[model samples]
Target: MEDIHALIQKLDWDTSEAEQAEAIHKLQDIQDEELRLLLQPLGKEYWDGAAEVIVKLGYPSVKPILPGLLEWIQDMNWPGAGRIAPLLREIGDPLIPYIQDVFRNHSQDEEWMYWIFEMIIDYWDKDQIVQIQEELIRLTEGKIIALKALRTLWVHQIYSGESVLLLLEDKMQRSLTEIAQLEIAYPGIDCEALGRGFSEAIFTPELSRAYIEEHREEFNFCHRKSTLHDFVSEIEELVSECMGSGNAPA
Candidate 1:
């Protein structure tokens, strides 16, 4: 552990790229939290190395660092936002609140907010649908990012197609066509699958159900159903099959 700590201390963010890469690889072998924490300050200059450290530590080891990482999002000077986003992305829903809070507050620096919003729409508590709706309104604000966010929400069913259609009622035809085109162009590669998989692997059904209920509007849209009831029925059948098959939940 001391040797690991020494290696972390010796990590030079300004080092040659080869040296930095070597430090990152060496850091991946250390498992102690105190040692990990000792290396936390390195995140500022060695963002990639920090990310590798976090991933090496995994969730339990990294959990302690979350609050600090969340606080780092607001650090104007830290390039931690971009580096942290991928780590949080790797951590997935277990880190949802931290990600959501960043989006909720409109933390736009580093585009971390956008990344967080994308992750939440993909994997957060379905009950957060209302929050997602609010976020869509707040962050998107009619820009290209918003359009992209909206498309993400639509794909994940974070907002029901009806809700989105209603929101864009003024441009329904155009938006719907755009959404369909975007869906095919991008396919099912958004946060939804990741969220569902995380939910099944780490969360309870009740929690999963809450996520579903919160995002029923979006789910309804995915099924091409006009009503929530139809969507719910389909979800039940899917859930049953998933559980019976011993597949990863999603």
Candidate 2:
């Protein structure tokens, strides 16, 4: 544990690159139960560098870290499932079942569920990603467990290049608008950040118009395109060009 302490003391963004790499390398070598123990609390905002130490330990580290992450979620510990999802993703596809089970068990915690979706984008293969898009669409079409689900689907649809507006109802549209206006720490997630595309996807002209139409007197619809159906058509064309002639995603 002294090694863990010494190595962690060296892990700072301000440190020299060589120092950072050396600390990470040494942390990776620990490769034991103690390393996993460090992962539990380190998964949070401050001690995340320690989490990276376990991440550097890679697949072998997965088995030990995962159970603790899930337990924290199940027990509603601080930071909870939302913080752990991306950390879990660092170990990749092996944790799919654990992630899936969380949705089944704690489906009502919406933001955490969406974080899980974002994590899959970095880890899962293309086919698995397709399945995620479909499942998210299905989830959005039904009674939502968390309002954030629509926003999650909205971003997935941007990449899927699918017509999200057509699949969604008025309520889902409102949910999307709410998230568009929500204060999020963009490029903030661990493993991989949400990126600029997510911001643009949520504020698409079509969704903006829907919000304006719903609350006509609330605000000006400055985002409205010259054609009422303009953004939808652009998205369709984009889908066709990107995916080729076939309606199915390539």
Whole-model lDDT values for every prediction: 0.54, 0.49
In the range 139-214, model 2's lDDT, one tens digit per residue, is: 5544433223444543334333244334433544554454445324222222112223334445688865564465
Task: In model 2, state the lDDT of residue 53.
Answer: 64
Error of 2 at 151 (Å): 11
Residue 52 accuracy (lDDT) in model 2 = 61
Per-residue lDDT of model 1, residues 144-228, tens digit only: 3454455456545565454544444434444455556656755555445645754674468776777777766555455442323
Off by over 4 Å in 1: 3-5, 13-45, 68-86, 107-110, 117-145, 158-166, 169-250
- Where model 2 places Cα greater than 4 Å from the true spot, the runs are 12-21, 40-48, 67-92, 121-123, 126-250
Global fold similarity of model 1 (TM-score): 0.45
